[model samples]
Target chain A: MMEITEGSHAVAEAVRLCRPQVVSAYPITPQTHIVEALADFVANGKLDAEYITVENELSALSACVGASAAGSRTYSATTSQGLLLMTEVVFNAAGMRLPIVMSIANRAVGAPLSIWNDMQDSISLRDAGWLQFYAEDNQEATDLHFLAYKVAESKEIQLPVFVCFDGFILSHTYEPIDMLLQEQVDQYLPKFDPAEKLDAKDPISFGMYATPEYYLEFRYEMDQAQKRAKDVIAKAGKEFGTMFGRDYSALTVGYLLDDAETVIVAMGSVCGTVKDAIDEMRAAGKKVGLLKIRVFRPFPSEEIAKALSKVKRVAVLDKNISLGAKGGATAIEVRDAMYGSMIPVKGYVLGLGGRDIRKKDIKEIVSLCENGIGDQFYGLRKELI
Target chain B: MTLAVGCRARPGKSRDNKTGSWRVFKPSFDHEKCSKCGMCQTLCPEGCVHEDAEGFFDPDFTYCKGCGICATECPKEAIAMNQEEK
Candidate 1:
């Protein structure tokens, strides 16, 4: 049924349907509504689960680490500084291969402090061993959670999954989302049964010190699981689409690329604006297209390269920059993946600290690609510099 | 190896793991001096020490790291630290 619901409530409703035995979180700007709604669900007996409001991000994730290790399906949500604070245990959860599903309301990391939208926070932790998925809208954000839990619990790829949506932009926006019935979700995602967890009757210690002999091997194994998870993601995504209507098997979706000379690549909610811009540019006879990256980690390099293999020029719009580097995280990864192809992929960093990225910005980026004048800061105010 | 091999979530499997090789010093027990007070058993870091049938405690060397905590805590001086055997 279609409902005009706040994005955060939609996500919380999805979590309720998934029936995670434990839901823990710490309140953070733009992300608090998600956990607060769930807290209400648990309190009113609407959802029979333990809803914990931990004092800080560290304890919130640490609580999830313990709950997931104890054989329960776990869910948590956080943003920006809250995410940065939990960085250690975020790594520990994946290092221990706990299948906990987390929602990252993507926001800008601050030196001066701004609670706003950006991809930097989650993008910074790209190599932390968790499967990362970026959503373009509230519907995708809600759907990705269902898909995330399925993929995380796959026997071949038992790892944590992060469902990331833009902070406030998507989290606070109200949109009509078609939600599935409870029975449909139950059929799609069965109860959490695990091959391993902390059972007192069958005690086993994890996160043990690996000697030099085994440390490298453990890391190597994490890499291999990530490589394997590529196939698992595709398979699980297909199964989900078959059961529901929205298919997401393709990691990179290209719009109007058939004979386009220039293509703009992006991720997260900004893709919505990019797509709208692409439509206007197409009407003006500009040979342009849009490529949206749905999954960031396990970085989908091969699929992305293949999608853009035919374009003449590629402009990457990154919402987060890797400081001291010439380009941002998404641009750096795209450029490296398309290396040796002679495509001249340009980097355009834009929308830091939730700066407005209008259609004019997307059009300008594409126009710069067309004129071979990109590979520079997007919408840069030279006066400010 | 496609699955995460080191990320074990189960409990009770620590018993299967061996840890004594980390030892540079091994604890040697003097049975005649032991009053069977169980201090060594209670003070063991690895939880591998056990009180045997006669109430005398012994460390399971298989998982003991030989940290010398048992010898330092033994009130009767019944335990001594020795270089680990080859």
Candidate 2:
């Protein structure tokens, strides 16, 4: 059914349809609506699940870890500082191999303390061993929840996942979403059947201490599982497309790259603005296009290489910076992907702390990539500096 | 051999690892001075101290790292941490 709804409520409805056995979360800005809606569902008897009202984000995820270990499909959501608070257990959940699904209403982290939309929070934890999916719009945000659970609960890939959508930009905004019916979702996602669980009938221990002799091997296996997720994501995404009409089979999706000389790479809701900018630029005879990355983790190097093989130059727009690194995280990886090909890749750190990324800014970035004048902060207030 | 997913293992696998090898000093029980109060057994961090048929507590030594917590906590000074003679 298609209806106009807030993005957080849409995500909550999608999660409800997936039939999560446990929902635990601490209410933080932007993220509060998602858990609030889920709480309403459980309270009104619309959904049969345990709603754990926790005091903080750490406990929210810790509750999820315990619930998931005990053989229940669990979920949690948070953003920015809340996500940072859950850092220790974030690594533990992935290391323990619990297939828990989390929704990250992507927000900027702080020294200055701004609760605005940015990719910094989730981007900071890219190495924490979770499959990350960035959505371009609310519809993709809603749809990705179903896809996240299916992939996370797969026997071969039992790692956790982060379905990241821009905070306030997508979460607070109302958009027309084609919400899946309970029966349709049921047909797509099976009940969570854990391969190993905390059952007293057959005792087992998880997250045991790995001595120096065994620690390296455990990490190697985790790396291998992450590499294996590419195939699992492809299969699950294809299956979702087969069932639903919208296909998300590609990791890096291209828009008008057939005869383009310059390509702009980005993730999250900014892709919507970039697309509109690209259409306008195309009319004025600028050979420009976009390659929006849906999957950020297990960084799709090979697919990215193939997609941008013909482009003369690449511009990566990052909402988060690596601080001391030469470029943003996405640019650093994109450059590595196109290393031997000798394509000039430039990275621009823009839209931090919810600074507006207007179409004019994107158009100017395209011009900067064309004129060979990037690889620095794109928009800075010189007068303020 | 395939590793268990998530480094999970069956219970009691710690038995295979003899932590006692880490002991630099062994706790020797002076049974004559012992009160049979089971203080050593209650205070053992590794739970390796147990009572025998005579009701006198002794450390299992297989899993004891000789931390000497029981020796320190014993009221009657019945347990002593003697340096292991290499």
Candidate 3:
């Protein structure tokens, strides 16, 4: 069934169809509605699952971790501080190779406390050994949940997955989405059965320590597992599109980059705004294009290099900052991915701490991509300040 | 770095095998009571304990050097120590 719905509601519907055995979380704004809806499903008997409302985000992840080890599909969602608080468990889940799916409502971390959109919280944990996927709109957000389960539960790639959507942008924005039927989702994602689990009848070791001589090998094995996910992700995504009518580009999805002289690179909700600008600029006969990076970790370096191989200039726009560093974090990675290539890569840091990023601002970015300095910063008004 | 396996010392000048060089001491378990839940195995900083085919657990005394970590961390309390004569 298709319906015009808020992005959060769409996400809730997608999660419901996935049929998680355990849904546990702590309530934080922007991410609260997601868990609240799941709670409703559990309360109303719409979904048969254990709904664990913990005191804090840490325990939320902890409870899910416990449940997952006990051999059940588990889920949780959080924003900013709640995400940060769950950092330990986040790494643990990945290290343990549990196929737990998390929805990170992209928000800024706080000492001053701002409940707004930014990719800082999720971006900071890029090296924590989880596969990361960013959604550009409500449709993508809804679809990524299904893909997340498939990718995470694959026998070759048994790692946790994070499906990130911007806080209050996609979370609060309304859009028309074609919801997948429960049977369709079932066809796409089979029940999760971990190779090893905490079975009392089995009585085996879980998370045993390795000595210095052996610890590095375990970490290396996990790295190898992530690399295997690349192929599994592509196959699963393509199959989902064939069965459920949603073809999510598993790695990097490009738009109109062929023979393009200037390109703007971006992710998340901002990419939708950039695409509108690209269409307008292309109609004016300007050789401008946009590349939306769907997967941020296990970064599709080779795919990205192949996509941007022909481009003469690239302006990477990031919604998060690395703080006192050279450029936007994603831009740095994109540039490195194109390191040996001859493309002139530039970066622009924009929309931090939930700043408004209008289409005009993205157009300005395209202009900068055309005839301005490399590594520019957008959404800054120095004179007004 | 040499692997700890071939380690030996001169007679009478031989180091006490009990505590090795460590000041603190921790107990190791016999293969009898270990259920091999791996609670202590994962939590140990020294990573001294090992498991066998029957799910029994053992700690390497050469590397263990008595941290007491595995003793307290064990969920089943399967380990105890014999203190050296004062």
Candidate 4:
């Protein structure tokens, strides 16, 4: 059904269609609407699920971990400080190999308190063994939830996933989304039938203490599973495209790179603005394009390298900085992917703490990249410094 | 060898570890002075102390780490922790 709806409501509807047995979350800004809509679904008999009201984000993800371990499809949502609070359980859920899917309403972490959008929250947890999918719009945000569960629950890749969309940009905005029917989602994603679960009859333990002799192998196996998820994600994404018209088969999707000299790479809802900027730049005779990264965890290194192979220079727009590093996390990884190619890769860190990133800002960044003036924070107020 | 997914294991695998090798002190049971109250068995953290056929309790050295809880909890002072020669 094609209807204009709020991003959070659309995601809530998508989650309802997936039929998670347990939905656990603590309400945080931007993410609250999704869970609130879900709570209404469970309340009005629209969805058959247990809505576990937790006290905080830690308990929220902890409840999901417990429910998922007991062979139930579980979910939770958090952002920024909330995600930081759930850090311990986050790693435990992945290490335990529970196919729990979480929604990360990407928000900026605070010291000088701010409630806004940035990729810092989920980006900081990139190495935690969970597959990350960044959404470019509300439609992709809503649709990625279905793909997240399908891939997470696959037998060969039973790892948790984070479907991250910009906090206010996607979660609080209204857009026309083609919501999936329950029947369609059911055909795409199967029931949560875990190979191992916490059944009293089975008498097995999960996440048991591993001595030095076995701990390394356990970590190695988890890494292997994460690597295997790339194939599973591609297959599931293709199947989804076959069932639904929207395909997400590529980890990184390119726009107008056929004869481009400068390529702008990014993730999340900012890609929408970047695409618009690229179109405008193309009209002005600038050979610019975009390579938006959909998946970040099992980073499409080879695919990314191949996609940007012929570009003259690369500009990576990172919404989150790596703190002490010269560039954002995405730029660091992209540079590593483009290693030995002799291509000059420039990183521009911008839009932190939800400073608006407009088409003009992207154009300015492209000009700066052309002038070889990058690897620094973009759009910083000179007076403040 | 293939490891279990998620480091999961079946119950009772703890018995194979022989944790008694970690014991520096061993609990010697003095059954002659013992009352069959089973306090030592009740207080054993490892649950390694079990009652013999005569209703007196002895610690199973195979799994007991010699924590000395049994000796301290014995109401009759019938258990003693002595330094193991090993």
Candidate 5:
């Protein structure tokens, strides 16, 4: 039987089920509940794991990488500033092929430092060799932990996984999250055994400096591994569906995409609101759709292009900026994918730095797509013309 | 031996050794053919291709990825892709 609980508590329970040998994380608003609940589980002896209270997010990921290297399943959590601080180690975890699953409460990285929901923090590190999954709700967030672990630990693609959820919107808000039971989780995720470990039995050098002659090959191999992960993610999601009765799309999620002429492409918690908007729009006989990007790092180019190719127009809503570029980071990737395909996809920069993302704003974005103008900014406060 | 579709046959290892095996010439200039166009010099991303003291051009294949961009983009067709044995 699955328990219906708050999103943070649900993710915490799921992590506990994964039975990580070591758990480490720093405290940050909106992402605090996940760590706090894990700490509670540790204190109560419900989880048999080493819970390390780290000084910073860098240490948090570093501890996870160390534990994973030592042949153990590890877990961690963080938000905006915390995620930003851990960026270097995040890349290291992926490059080193450590299968650590981290729950990132997606927040706006800022000058003002607001602890609210947005995709900026994680979006900034899209090329950092991690398998990223943006959860639309508490239930998806809970289930993604299991799926992320399976895919990341797969022999074909051993990389760290970032299961992203909106900061305040999904992390703080209470929702009916149906989390799997302990026995089921155990049945689904077998004990993690690293093929190559930092063990005394086989003393091998790790992260050694490579010269120009060998460095490009190593990076290319890592890129090739990530490409391999695309298939692994799909296979894992399929196995998960059979075991737990939930199907999570590996790369992209399509809502009313079939027979629709225009679509709004989004990610993270904003997708939930976008879906709601799409439902209402369809009810009024509008042929609009939504495509939520679940995996950003791998770019999901072919999948995104295939999904949006049939549509005449698309509005790519991005929460992160490339700064000095014409399009947002993800928007540029999507546009590049659709470049020769003849699909008129426009990019919109919106909801940056914890700004409120209302459903009406998404509706306006779709309406703008209908207008056929190129790229435009949405919800930007203007003083005077 | 039958090679795979895209796989090229490896030349003699000893012969390659004698002639700088798998070395990429990357086109050092023939000044007689060179117009001092600086086409190859300008297009190289690695900055390996450059003008010499005599205004003739040369490419330092030691640092090149062999991306062939310079060879592809030289307007004068001065840069030719040459292969040396390893």
Candidate 6:
């Protein structure tokens, strides 16, 4: 049944349906509402699970790691600083091959104390050995959790997953979500029976120090599992579509790209605005399209390159910077993907520290692409500079 | 030899890791000088040390990486981190 719910609560409703055994989270803006909703489910007996509220994000994720290793389906939620703090233990969960699902309310990391939405938080941990998924809207965000656990627990891919949704925008916005019924979810995501788990009766150790001789193999094995997950994600999406009505089979979605002359590439809630802009531009016969990336890690380089093969120019937008690096992380990755393809891929930085990227911004960027405008910042106030 | 398909090991009793081979200096307990304080047993980082029937602390070296803290922390100087014969 369809019901109007806040995005965070919608995700909580989805999580409740899946019946996580343990949930540990530390409170931060945007993500606060998510963990709060889960805590309420545990508090009101709506969800039969252990709701653990920890002092900090490190311990919060650490608790999830311990519980997950102990053969329990576990969850944790965090934002920018919280995600940063959880980094050390977070990597352990991946190396230990625990299938813990984390809901990342994508927010800007701060020295200036930002609470607004951006991709920097999770993107910074791109190599932390977790399967990463970005949602264009609340519905996809909610659905990715199910897919996250599915792929995470797959025998081939026993890795943690980060289902990232834009902070504030998708995390707080109310939208109509077809929250899956408990029975339907149970049919899709069966009770987690991890192949490897810690037992007092049959003791085992995980995340042991791999000697130099054995370390590279462990890392290679993890990469192989991620490669396997690319297929597993598609399988899970297909299965999810068959059971539900939404098709998430593609790793990347191209809006108006089949006959597009110019394109703007983006992710997260900004894609929604970009889609609206593409429609407007198409009405004016501008021959513009938007290439929205759903999975940034294990990057869909070939898919992205193929999507824009016919397009003349591409503008890659990033809500986060790579600090002192060349361009945004997505831009660098996209350029790497487009290597040898010879497409004029330009990188544009925007929405850092939660600055809004309206539909007009997308239209202007496409216009800029058509006008042969090269890589530069979009939506920057020159007066402020 | 073929490694496992994934990073996953056999999932129990990794007694074959042969971590004791990593011990450049192995801890050897001297029963004659032992006070039976069980300090070696408590100080062994591997927790592989155990009291024998005579209450002398002896370590099961199979699982021990052997940092030699047991020898270093022994109050009665009853333990020695001796170089391996090899």
Which is the leading candidate under DockQ? 4
Error of 6 at A232 (Å): 0.3
* lDDT (tens digit, per residue) of candidate 6 on A1-385: 8989899998888888878999999889989998888898899999899988778999999999889988999998898999999999988888888999999999999889988888999999999999889999989999989999998999888999999999999999999888888888999999999887878787666776665557798889888888888888888999999999887777899888888888888889999898888888888888888888998766888888888888788899999888788678998898888888778888888999899998888877777767777567778899998
Q: If you assessed candidate 3 against the hidden native complex, which CAPRI class would it receive?
A: incorrect
Error of 1 at A3 (Å): 0.8
In Å, residue B68's CA in model 4 sits off its true spot by 15
For each candidate, the alpha-carbon lDDT, in order, equals 0.88, 0.93, 0.83, 0.92, 0.80, 0.86
- For DockQ, candidate 2 versus 4, the one ahead is 4
Clashing residue pairs for model 1: A202-B11, A203-B11, A203-B12, A203-B13, A204-B11, A204-B12, A204-B13
Q: Each predicted model: what fraction of the native A–B Cα contacts (within 8 Å) does it retain?
A: 0.57, 0.72, 0.00, 0.82, 0.00, 0.10
Stretches of model 4 off by over 4 angstroms after superposition = B15-86
| Model 4 complex DockQ against the native | 0.55
The RMSD of every model to the true structure, in order and in angstroms, is 5.5, 4.8, 10.5, 5.0, 10.4, 5.7
TM-score of each: 0.85, 0.87, 0.83, 0.87, 0.81, 0.85
The alpha-carbon lDDT assigned to residue B80 of candidate 1 equals 93
Winning candidate number (TM-score):
2
Name the better of 2 and 3 by lDDT.
Answer: 2
* lDDT of each residue in A7-109, candidate 3, tens digit only: 8889998999999999999999999889889999999999999998788999999998888878899998888999899999998888878889999999987
3 versus 4: better DockQ goes to: 4
Ranking by DockQ: 4, 2, 1, 6, 3, 5
Residue pairs in clash, model 3: none
Candidate 4 per-residue C-alpha lDDT over A195-286 given as tens digits, one digit per residue, 9 for 90 to 100: 79998998888888775556798899999998898899899899999999999888989999999999999999988899999999999999
- What's each prediction's clash count? 7, 0, 0, 0, 4, 0
Model 3: lDDT of residue A298: 79
